[model samples]
Target chain A: MRNQLRRPLATISVYGINLLHRQNPYVVAWWSAAFPGFGHYLLNQYIRATLLTIVEVIINYLTNINIAIVYSFCGEFDMAKSVVQPRWAIGYIIIYFFIIWDSYRSALVQNKLCHLAQLENERVAAVNLRPLEFQYIEPKKPWLAALYSFFFPGLGQLYNHQFALAFYAMMWWWIYLTLSRAHESVTLMMVGNFQESIAVLHPQWLLFMPSVVGGSTYYAYIMAREHNRLFRIEQRQFLAERYSHSEVRLFPR
Target chain B: MLVIGTFEHSLELEQALSLLEHDGIARKHILVILMDTDPKNPNQFLSKPTDLYPNAIEVGTAFATACAVIGTSVGFKLAWGPIFSGLSAAVGGFIVGFGLYLFVKKGIHKTRSKRLPEICVIVQCTEEQVELVTETLWKFGVLTVGRVKEPSLRA
Candidate 1:
């Protein structure tokens, strides 16, 4: 009876968001196929995703991949061949395919890990000694988290209560943006100053943007999903402790 | 000889290391690798434990010294006709030594990559002390234990 009295009646929403749903592995794979590190972002493997994205953009640019594709589409095969630096292009092919394969594999593995974690949470709840009082949290929406991260590199992590990671990410992102002059270049390009825009951009620093954006977006989504799962398990545990078996029936007679 | 053991938890690994220390194993002979299982635990994931290859620097220096000596001798012999053999020999020796140092460093890195794992303890000991070392590890409830072939202090 003391346990019942001690238990909090109200459910608290930790992040004040709704429950996160499971993501399809194929969908994640498709995202990665579209963009090299997108799948890793969806899987919440931030560092790997970031590194791969960085590699992808830099290699793609160095190999003149965009120009080659453009020339090929225009039926200028010779021009395409001329533009591509074979040395860098060969390395680009290896990394690009590897990223796609790795992201797909990681998605499958993370799905299994998520299932195992859920089971573990259930087991832990049964033996947990603490009273389920005062600290209730709600589920998070993955898409919203991703959207927040899209606006700012580390905002999603801040939402997830990961302060240090958010700080570092924000700091690095700001530095990259400043050093690359990416925004200014885009603005100039939009104003029909193509040569001036090209001159303003620093390829070395600009190359880092794709990876940072891909990593941030994906990380935000994954973290939100994980946070929601944890919230659900906690809520279940709290519910289990607060109500007795006799009081809460699955089906009424 | 080297004995390698894996442990599930850091506490158990620490206990095992302490037991090994109590048994008179030198601190330098023991190496531990702690793998992070929890993403929330930043301390575990972020900490880069010192590498096991303590002798890499010493080995690299030895190789560099040998190469430098050979280069100096060759340069002195080739420049016998009085053009400050000391300066040419010094430059040649430095270049050769630096190159050999880089090569040795690469080899050490390759060896480490091939042998090391995320969560294992490696201990270097004499052939006579292998049994005692394995026994101590077992007593502390190690997850697995085995003898590694050609276990050098350089690992």
Candidate 2:
């Protein structure tokens, strides 16, 4: 008697809540905005919603704090106020929009996924489905290429016999390193350590100057050498191992 | 749990169970292990649990096929750098392979809550849920439903 009455009451409560869920997406969205992922919890998607909330908050907090630190150091409060806070505030707003967009999209996706699962269950019950099947595919070797790229950006690509890619990567790597090195040298020269700048400034021995000539050359060479070593590994792998069909099947034969 | 060997078909599973049954192994003593199936051709199946159970196994041929096709397409597109394209293809292959496995596991866990096994069905639909499924089944009609988890493993 009492048990029967309790059962219907419990069911009614569940139905009432579910009805609320379907009726107002805005309520869910509002809760989510108020407290990261509250909407997801309401929708019964706890994990993804929680992760999104945590990541968004942490990223926002970190970015804001970093910007605040930069302003604090600038010392001029009025200048910092006009420049820093608004810039950071705009960034924060952008981040918030991104988070909102991602959350809304993910939530809708999860809802569809859940509905599909429910339908699948119903179908399984209604029809005779075949047992689950398993098809094997061999693993691909990326470490070779990754390592190759690491040594000599272009060399590894070249060793893989990817002449054009190797050339492009190498050219870009060279350009970046050269520009950075030149910039570093100029900054060092501007520091004006007197005797050190004088030693490098004389044209007669400019080739031997520590600041202008030898500076950044070693670093550039090191970067280039490192990229080369990486490519060597790819060369070795291509020669030594017989890549399985699935591994190279994505390419041609 | 006492994993009844990894077999490709339900009929094979039934056969293995029958062998144990004939050897005086009680029905309660057996656990039908659903090993991870191959990602490419999910129905083709494999016996290696370590390989199959990895978190990255995909369930269909579509993803891998797409990857291979894409690699070939990219290779043709960049005819100037066949070698570099090949390397890219290799990396892409690994990603697609690992991706399939993750996708399937995620799909399974996502859909698990809606399944009958996950419902925690009460034996009498009245008794509190016992820790084991057999106990609940016994309450319904299966008198000899055996314990198949931790205790069965010990035996």
Candidate 3:
């Protein structure tokens, strides 16, 4: 009688566990807010998210530069007149949709992950079973890894013995920041202030001026966002190290 | 030292204690481990495995509480010097603690514990006879058993 009763109870508990394991929408929401298509990437729909993020970023850059260029040439009042350009309004719409869609996609993915997690938990709980065992090589100290990254981005991953990823992150960011500083300096040397340049430069310089201002602004934004992401990576590393329960053990010779 | 219990908010050491009564776990048994004070555990509650662990409960609670307090105080505290200053301090403290917690939790809790395979067992049962093995190993209270699950994989 006891066994029979327990079996049904266990089944119900398993079901509940499955339900509880569903992915959370909060993560998607957070990611979308953090980076345009980050939520979609989180959901494993990588290609779409990447395309959307890239397109939206490009459009955003163009629009921002256009606004700045117009202001530089004609002042704030002329911003209204500049809207008639071929793709400006359309670009705005695309960027807006991308942001909204990314957020929505993130929510959907979280919900799915949650459900899958619950189902898995329920299946395991139903059986009087133990977790399977195997040898695990714990990563090196997580906090130190993170601290390394914090002081010098990507160094932590190297310390944790992930040399390839460390090298990539470091190389990419180094190139980016260096290039960005160089570009900014050149822009100042060549053009002075955007608004002032519009007043001073001859018609020959005018043609290139718009593209220059626009490119610099967009690149700056991208670099800043990337820097933020790297900083967070460090934070992540430290947390993993301090909180992880992995331990090193010695085997008999 | 074994640390136990966590506050719903990162209050001052004294304030956190005031919120909860002493339960079976003696006050001395539990330490209010501040992430700020301990540079080693900079992001104590934020990352993967630890974020999902049961031990992270207090850290989460503290962060949530801090967010609530700070968010609520945004508009009202702009009036006077003492009130504004006090609120500002509280907000600053909470933000720093909560940011560290969030960063740690998000980074660490990204993986699911069950999906990954990481366990080891070494039991010497060959020498024992069948009856002894069944009795000693299978018995409810015979051999000591332990489990280690990746907290990051948790829901």
Candidate 4:
């Protein structure tokens, strides 16, 4: 039973074992506020992020929170207050604050650990090859990653092998498109039915798209650049160990 | 005597280290600091985020968020409506913000890398052993070598 119950914290696919680095607590908290699970996701706390994301979605839908937020943003406070299911919404409030605090505290602790780990200077296996997966330290261009993300919200993450985030963003992008009727609205607008285009859009859902797209693109670009640096560090460690032994010769014929 | 030398991080340098060890120099007395000049490792002018020195994640995220919010707000009045207008603005804003970030970061990174040692090897030994260590280093195509009678400053 113990053996069967065992689980790995991170893997090459599900959530890669990211390098330790100082992450800003405020940034992590801000992301949590942006989307409950996002801060935990950045911290590489996949399990928590997944759970929080599910709960957030369920609660948001049941409480009509998104609709309420839309009304609130549009300055219809009475409608906003009326649309929300008080009980469900109330439960989410605590979780929202908890996640922000949780992610912030976790980041601070993680930063300390990162400092210790760097001081230790332990070498890592730069290459991992398996029948199903190939992960290696290699150079990747930030610009190219950004371009891919610009084309689609998650393709850049996909390129970076950030499978969990890539898939998550893609799934949400599709959902956003469907709920907002963004494509349909664009089509209507293109065909000269401006009024119909405007009428078709769900502004609440559409508003979420900008932040998600912008964030994803920026994240992908930064990750690419960072990974390149990691590759160099890992490669340097490898070379020092592997190639530091050689015989000297005074003169060669 | 302390023998200090810098090499281009190649096989010859490794050979020199091995020869020094074979010449009865203890491993602990020999130090090697490798330079990051690998051909495959690009991004020579940018570095990973770390404690004091870091690539700012918040700046990009905050900039992107701000752009996204503004774009979305302005889209309410545009002809393409909110969807297309907001998206374009978000992307445009992200590019400008991130690019500006990289420009500043690159300058810092370039200077930091310049200060990094290039395949430096420091050997500590007595006056009697200096000749052997120096001979071994020179035989293997070392870049530059110097000797110090006494060590001082940042030992």
Task: Quote the true-contact fraction of every model.
Answer: 0.00, 0.00, 0.00, 0.22
Query: Mind sharing the TM-score for model 4?
Result: 0.68
Better of 1 and 4 by TM-score: 4
- Positional deviation of A3 in candidate 1, in angstroms? 28
* Segments in model 3 whose C-alpha atoms lie over 4 Å from true places: A1-24, A65-86, A121-175, A182-253, B1-155
Better of 1 and 3 by DockQ: 3
* Runs with alpha carbons beyond 4 Å of true place in candidate 4: A1-17, A247-253, B1-33, B36-58, B70-80, B88-155
- Tens-digit lDDT track of model 1 for A62-160: 887755654554467897799999989777778777777887777677556544443434322212123532222335667687667766788887776
Ranking by DockQ: 4, 3, 2, 1
Worst 10 residues of 4 chain B by lDDT: B43-52
Candidate 2 stretches greater than 4 Å from native: A1-84, A121-253, B1-155
TM-score of each: 0.42, 0.20, 0.33, 0.68
**After aligning candidate 3 to the native by TM-score, how far in Å is the CA of A243 from where it should be?**
28
Per-residue lDDT of model 4, residues A41-112, tens digit only: 677676788788778767867888766765665567898899899888778899889999999999898777
Model 4 / residue A98 / CA error / Å: 1.4
lDDT score at residue A42, model 3, on the 0-100 scale: 39
CAPRI level of candidate 3? incorrect
Clashing pairs in 4: none
DockQ of 1: 0.01
**Candidate number 3, chain A TM-score:** 0.38
Interface CA RMSD of each prediction in angstroms: 27.4, 27.9, 20.0, 8.9
